[model samples]
Target: MQGVDTVLNVLGSVCLLLWGVRMVRTGLTRAFGATLRRAISACARNRFTAFAGGVGLTGILQSSTATALLLASFASRGLIPLSIALAVMLGANVGTTLTAQVLSFNLGWVSPFMIAVGVIAFLSNSSDKARHLGRVAIGLGLMLLSLHLLEAAAAPLRASPAFVAVLSGLQDEYVLAVVFAAAATWFVHSSLSSVLLVMSFASSGIIEPKLGLALIIGANIGGAIAPYFDQSTTDVDARRVPLGNLITRVVIGAGLLCFLGPIHHWLAFIDPAPARLLVNFHTAFSLVAAIVFLPLNDPLAALCRRLVPSRPQADDPGRPRHLDPNVLDTPAEALACAMRETLNLGDKVADMLRQTMDALENNDARAVKAIEAADDAVDHLYEAIKLYLVQTSRNELGEEDGRRYVEILTFTTNLEHVGDIIDKNLMELATKKIKNRYSFSAEGTAELRAFHARVLENLRLALNVFTTRDITLARRLVAEKTSMREAEMHAGDSHFARLREGRPESIETSSIHMDVIRDLKRINGHLTTVAYPILEAAGELAETRLKPSDQTLMRAPAGS
Candidate 1:
């Protein structure tokens, strides 16, 4: 009965520890995700900088698994190269050990104060970033408290003869010990928690220091496994970083496991406390692995690529390329995926619009068919992005992420509207012109062509505005909406003048010409909608564009 209670308590403590680690990782990701992504990407120009970036980021994030998953997201999207990503993983491994080193110390005294402060800040602060930081502090406090509880829960087991015998058996079976720890860490999805658990057991004398060292090695190796399996994409590029990082850990961990006897003897001279010895060994092993592996990243990356060769996939522009399901838990990353997919949606619509002018001017039936067929792809991409954004919204999002989610959803919806206009309205007009072999006046053709060009440029700008959310670019995009309206009107007046001059081409194609310009203006209106959210967010948008009247009519009596 006592043993059962002990087991339950230990399990609960372990669960708390894992939850705390997750909270910290998620809070930091929510508050600083884009900045973290930009920082890592900026370092991609050089291997050393990339390595440093990984170390710093993982140190702040405190989870190599989190770092590994993030890099995998980037690699799958082709945002970061495989070799640079490998370098970052190496640094991340070292960074996580830094966390273990800090947690290994007795910091239980600070836990309550941190938790109180965190709770107060979380409840009091209105700013999203501050609230996230409070969550981080609370997570940290929970971690420290869990460590203390784990030690107490585990202390009782040290006195049990059966438990002692089981731990004693592991001292000789080093391979089993390492394998067990590796499996536990992999299952937990956190090496920090595993290492801390091992530290707690070693401090309680439930396991020999030498055995704890082997367990820590296994934990590090297992840390790499979760990310390798967590990648949602089948793209060979996306899987390379985690696989390469895993191989690196396995290689280093296997070698270290074999030399555990000598490593333990050497580390005993530094600090012989069982817990400290295991912690020191974990730190040293991570540092040594980073030093040895950093320079070999290129060759190692090549090896990973060779191991996981890219399978040829048919290029389907309609398919969602970057909506990786693995990142959906991280709203910032998931939003990025949706944004990329949305941009692809925009590209498809732009292609359709660009082809309309050529098809109408040449009376090319095949081009019109092609444009019509391409709209199906546009619809597919739009639906994919819309669904992806909906899934991302299910997660807890900060203000910034929530707004970006809406921005992405709104822009993709608008892109779909633009696609429909190009397909249903404009394509129908083209078919009519083509079937009748009608041609516009030379001047009218030039005018419509020029108008199409302007709309095309605005399409590009809208996409840029969606991506950058730059206020200046967004303002310009809105301004172009007015320009397009004026151009449509000008084209209308000019077509009427051509009819007055007795131009036969104008007389025959006047309706189609006017309809085409009207549809272009409609498309422009949809594209300009992308800029509205951006301007509104910055407080640059007016509630309505209507001017106030100088006089108002009185309301009539109800019946009258």
Candidate 2:
């Protein structure tokens, strides 16, 4: 029963460690994720800078896997070269080792103090950034506390005969130790936790330093596994970063195993303490990896490219290009992707609008069919953006991100409505006009085409508003609503004037002309809604068009 209790306590400590790491990671990601991404991207001009950036970022983030996943998303989108991404991964590996080195020290005294301070700060702060920082503090405290608890949990097991026997067996088999550590790290999805556990065992005299070193190597290899699989995509470029990272770790790790005996002997001379020896070896191995592999990023990337050849892109226009699923955890990047896909959706709708004039005036059957096909494409993209945004919202989001999320969803919904207007309403009018052999007067035709062109222009403007959120551009887009209405009214009056002149073409096509004008105006209305969110956000929009005094009802003046 004691043995079982000890084992359970050990497992519990490990779980706590994992949870602490998670809180820290999520806190940093939520707070400074966009800045970190931009920092990484800005360093893409050179490999060495990119390497440094990755090291610094992962040191702060405390998760190389997170760094790897972020770089993979960028690589997949062709924002950075595959070679540069590989360099970052090498640096990220070193960064994790740096974290382990810090945690290896006996800062157990600081754990409780940090926890108390963190709790106070988190609960008292209303600022989002302050709260996020507090969350980071709490996570760090928990991590340190978990380490102390883990050491205590392992103390009871050190005296157990069965535990000693298991340690003895592992000590005899270097390969088995590596494999065991690797599997354990992979299962937990955190190499830091695995390394800390190994450190605890070494510190407790439950495992020798040589065995601990082997286990660290395994942990290194295991660290790259989760990110590689998590970045699974049809694009080979995206897969290359993680795969290159894995290959580098495996090859370098296996090669180092042959020298493990000599390395352990050399480390013992510097400091014979088991825990320090393991921690130093882990740090040394990572630094050596970065030194050896940083220069070879280009060659390694080329090798991976050959291993995972790029597949041909799918022919479907409806398939989303920018909505990378891997970035959903990072809401800023995910929202950026959603924004781009929304623009893509807007482009499809614009194409449909552009084709409407040809169908309406020239009676072009092919143009009508193309517009219909374009609407179908718009629908597909709209659905894809909507679903992707839904997934993004599942992650914790800041106020700005939340607002942008709504803007994207609202804009896409409006674009979808615009497509429906083109497909169902305008196309139906075009079909009827063609079948009935209706032709508008010369003036009426010019006015209809001019109005169509103006609406198309507004569609482009709405997309610009969505993309930039420029107040000036948004205000212009909203103002066009009035111009469009007046144009519709003017066209109506002109049609009647032509009717009074007894123009045969106007009389024949009068219903279709009026319907066409109304449908174009309706499409314009949909496009115009994209501006309202932006204006309202800036407090430039009034609640209603009526004056404040207009709210009061006037009594009938002594009604007769």
In the range 1-560, model 2's lDDT, one tens digit per residue, is 98888989999999999999998998888778788888998878788988888788889999988888888878877899999888888888878878888998889988888888878888998777777778888899999999999999999987999889988998879899889888888888888888899999999988888888899999988888878877674467778898999998898899899999899889999888898899888888788888888888889988998999877866888888889775676788899999989988888888888888889888888898888888888888898999999999998688899999999999899999999999999999989888887777789989998999999999999999998999999999999999999999999999999999999999989989999999899989988998998899899998888754632535434552
TM-score, every prediction? 0.77, 0.86
Tens-place lDDT digits, model 1, residues 1-560 = 99999999999999999988988987888788878879999988878898888889999999998888888878887889899999999889888888888888889999999899889989999987788889999999999999999999998998899988888889889889989988988899998999999999999988888889889988998899888887645577878889999998889888898888899899999999998899898888878888888889889998998999988889887888878775676687888888888887888888888899878899888888888789989888888888888888887788888888888888888888888998899889989998898988899999999999999999999899988889999999999988888888888999999999999999999999999999989989998998888888789998887765544223444564
Clashes of 2: 0
Q: What is the C-alpha lDDT of each candidate?
A: 0.88, 0.88
Clashes of each: 0, 0
Q: What lDDT does candidate 2 reach at residue 275?
A: 88
Model 2's C-alpha root-mean-square deviation from the true structure amounts to: 4.0
Model 1 poorest ten-residue lDDT run: 549-558
Off by over 4 Å in 1: 1-8, 30-54, 71-85, 155-173, 208-211, 232-234, 259-269, 291-298, 310-315, 319-344, 387-404, 428-525, 531-552, 555-560
Model 1, 212: alpha-carbon shift in Å? 3.1
